[model samples]
Target: MPVMNPMQEPCSIMAQPPFRSFLVPGQPVSHPDHPEWGEGVVQSAVGHRVTVMFPHAGKVVVNATVVHLTELS
Candidate 1:
C-alpha cells in the first residue's frame, strides 16, 4: 500500500507566511546628516516617499530609499 502525504493549505491574508517581507507602522529609520528618525511610525506609503511620525518631530515625509530595514532579532 502506498502512503499519501497530506497537502498543505495556502497561507491566509492575516497569516504572515515565512519567506515574505512586509512593512508595518511604527518602525525606526536612519539617515546620515539628519537626526535619527528613531522609532517613527509609518503614517502612509506614497510612491517613493513614506510619511512617518516621529516621537518629537511629529509627522514628516521621508524618502523610501533612505529608510533602511532592520533585521528582525
Candidate 2:
C-alpha cells in the first residue's frame, strides 16, 4: 500500500458539510488549545493543515484534525 500524503489529498474539511461552510481563507479564528497564541487570521487551508497568522506566534501551521479552531466574527 502506498502512503497517502495529506497535502496531495482533497481537503476533508471541504468534504464535511459543517466544516466546509466555515473553513475559508481570511476567516478569523482562535485556537482553543493554545489560548496564549491569541487570535489569528486564517491564511490558508489545505487538506488537513491550516495556516494561521497569530499576533504573538506569527504564522503557525495547525493540524485541523487535532485542533478545532473557533471561528470568530
Candidate 3:
C-alpha cells in the first residue's frame, strides 16, 4: 500500500499575502535628519506625506518621498 499526502487547507490556495511595503498608523519608524527624535509612531500616511509622533520631537509631518523613514522592529 502507498501512503497518501494530506490535503492543503483553504488558505494555502490563496494568493501571496500582503507585502509590508506601505507603512500604516501605529507602526514605529525613524528618520535620518533627526535621529535624536528617536523612533516615532506613525499617525497617518497620505500620498507622499506621513505624520509621526516622536518621543522627544513630538508630532511632525514628513514627506515620504524626500525622507526614507526606517521601519523599527
Off by over 4 Å in 1: 1-37, 66-73
Report clash pairs, candidate 2.
Answer: none
Please provide, for model 3 over 1-73, each residue's C-alpha lDDT reduced to its tens digit, 9 standing for 90 to 100. Answer: 6555677455554776532337899999998889999989999987778899999999999888778899999
Local distance difference test values of all predictions, in order: 0.56, 0.84, 0.85
Q: Candidate 2: deviation at residue 10, Å?
A: 21
Prediction 3 TM-score vs. true:
0.68
What is residue 11's positional error in candidate 3, in angstroms?
A: 43
Q: Which stretches of candidate 3 lie over 4 Å from their true place?
A: 1-21
Candidate 3: pairs in clash: none
Cand. 2 TM to true fold = 0.67
For candidate 3, give the lDDT of residue 8.
44
lDDT of 1 by residue, 1-73 (tens): 6555577554475495433224455555533344565556666665556776767678877665655544222
TM-score for each prediction? 0.44, 0.67, 0.68
Clashes per model (N, Cα, C within 3 A)? 1, 0, 0
Top TM-score: which candidate number?
3
- State residue 29's C-alpha deviation in candidate 2, in Å: 0.4
